[model samples]
Target: MIQEIKPAIWQILGKQPGRNVVIIGGTHGNERTGVEVVSKLKSMIESGRLNIIRGTLVLIHGNPRAIEINERGSEPHADLNRSYLVDLLEREPTGIYEDQRAREIAPLLIVSDVVVDLHATNKPSEPFIACADSSGHEQVYQWFPSKKVLSDPNYVLAGKLVTTDEFVDAHGGTGLCYETGQAGDVTRVDEVMRNVINLLIDQNLVEGEVRIPSNECEIYEMIEPIVLTAVGFTFAEGFGNGSWEPFVADQTIGYHGDVPLVATYDGVVVFPKIQELRKEGSPLAYLAKKVNERKKPPRD
Candidate 1:
């Protein structure tokens, strides 16, 4: 049956007991694809057009306030996606809207068996999935069509970044983040939504035959983040064109002052911050190499 857990959160509890599934959208507020997908699912359930049969399905609107204003975040410098750390969730509420949302969402994630947080990029880029390398994560992500998987098992982003997926993973759940390409693009919505429904069916949370993708995923293990320095930084001419753009050894990713930031091995730059979003003390971009490309390639 359909039930509202909060203003923007809903629960569809199945009669049979099974895994606790949580799906989140609008984590960035401006990423409308996820919001659209989850909202449709909620409406279907509410209208008796869709039904859950095996587990509790939680539909969450990650940041309704930001969505109302159609902005990346509800407040300046307070990203809802980056507010899932344990300390922040445990402490007295800072009264930040995102923080309070994180705290309210924490309990659901802690007991969830699977969590999928949908998102979109600010710049033009290929769609991809981000999650720690694990069998649980593999089971969920394989259902999606995106082949580029960013696996950050080491907490490489200065070990300070705690996102929704990472938070769910900490408590032994399969958490997956699906970036559905550029923020304004709606072309992939139908495809993404189909895969999400397939996942629900495959997990037996909903009744249907499962559809599986045959494409093998290319895994990129995160090496480290390129931190923006106080002197400032700039992307190389061909780099920062998009996420997952490849770079070769010694190729300059950008420059900090007059010093060049060069790659040490063949890899891709992930999540390069656009000029307007660039902030010092935070990652300007992250360097990652394919799982098999960790060893330096043979050169003449």
Candidate 2:
């Protein structure tokens, strides 16, 4: 049976208890694919087309207020996707829409066995997966078709846990973020939906014949996120537009004012910030190098 847990959160319980799974959409309100995916799942379940067979399935509309206005976030200071930090979740309400929303959603994440936070980039790009290296994380990501995986073992993204998947991982759960290309594109909705359904089946949360897809992936260990400096930063030339761009050792990446930002090693730059999204102290872009193999975290 499916029941509304909150304004934009719903819980579907199976007769046989199992893993607690939370699938979040609209975390960044402008990411339409996730929002649409959750909406479609709700409709499918409500209309008797989909079934939850053995576990609790939670569907969350991550930032309803921002989603209502069709913006990345409702507040200027807080990003819902980055508001899940421990301090923020444990503190008294800050009156910021996204911060307060994170507080409301923390409990669900605390109890989740698996979390799939759907997202999309602001600029055009191919789909990719981001998560820490772990056995649990590996279990889910293999089901997706994305060939590139960013493994952040040292928390270079924000210097600490902030994203939904990161928070989930902190509490000993499998968490992953699926970037479904650009926010405005909906071409992959059906494909993404099918992938999630297949995941549910594999986990025994839904009944079906599970056909696990290829697990081969080009793993990249995240080196660091290049923070926009006070003097401001800019990609050297023809870079930082979007997607992945490769650079050789000692090559000039961009400029921090008049100072040249040079690459330390051969790697690919992913998730380059467009001009509008660039902010002092925020990530302008992130660097990663292809790894020979992934190192899984020790099981608890």
Candidate 3:
């Protein structure tokens, strides 16, 4: 049976501990790839197919109730992933369900050496890794050879709770958001889950034979993520993953009515929203680079 810590943090502790690698899934409730992956890993360990090394592998089910309903909001209709900022916790305290969940998991993350949070997008797109502008970026990039890397330099928004890239930077450990594919797609989920498990083993977090991808996938270094607000409207209905070609220098992609939401620099689109939600704004898209093209790729 899976072990529970409070209502959000769950773990399957190994026989011994040395280094610690935390794998978090279902942070968004609807995105279930990481959850399934963790479950499978636990089964392997219990059945003696996989072995724990010098470190402990902790599988955190981010939002259990949300996963059960397959919606972004947990039981209290809060986005758990965006609930990590310290101020938010102190202010409202129990304003949202995600806030409470963050309180429970923050301490657990503080002690981890490496954290990988798995996610699935609403639109179909290739798998990629997201990291903050911190030393950990180098480590995580080298750990999981992705086709692209999304590096955001902005101060992480306080609203994003537990798995924010900022927390990883603050703690001096590598933190990554692995976007697998469209929500609830088992095929894509399996592909990402297998990759994550293999990544842990390859990085020496666990003791097992895990295959790392031979060819690195495309890498996208996000210079900036255009945040949507009430005033602007993303050109809906036509946008889908890989729908548009990589933006050319100073090319326009969308408009706030007449104002152009152009690409200041050229890169591929990563997360384009297709579904409607309660929130007015969403990530319009991201700029990225192919991994091989980077001047200096992230290293261990």
lDDT score at residue 74, model 1, on the 0-100 scale: 90
lDDT of 1 by residue, 48-148 (tens): 87889998999999999998888889976668988888566558887888988898888899999999999998877888999876656777887887778
Clashes in model 2: which pairs? Answer: none
Clashes of each: 0, 0, 20
C-alpha RMSD for every candidate? 4.2, 2.0, 3.7
Once fitted onto the true fold, the runs of candidate 3 whose alpha carbons sit more than 4 angstroms away are 75-77, 86-92, 133-145, 156-163, 203-205, 209-219, 225-245, 281-283, 286-300
Residue-level lDDT tens digits of model 2 in 1-300 = 789988899999988989898988899888999999999999999999999989899999999998888888986545887788866655777678788889889889988999999999887788999987666787888777787888888888878888999899888788999999998798999998988898898888999897666566777888988898789887877677676788888999888898988777888888786676778889978988887553343453
Q: Model 1, which residues run further than 4 Å from truth?
A: 293-300
Model 2 spans with C-alpha error above 4 angstroms? 87-89, 293-300
Q: What is the TM-score ranking, best to worst?
A: 2, 1, 3
Query: In candidate 3, how many Å is residue 226 off?
Result: 3.7
Which candidate would rank higher by lDDT, 1 or 2? 2
* lDDT to native, each model: 0.84, 0.85, 0.64
Residue 208's lDDT in candidate 3? 77
Q: Model 1 scores what on Cα lDDT?
A: 0.84
What shift in Å separates residue 283 of candidate 3 from its native position after superposition? 4.6
lDDT for residue 60 in candidate 2, whole number 0-100:
93
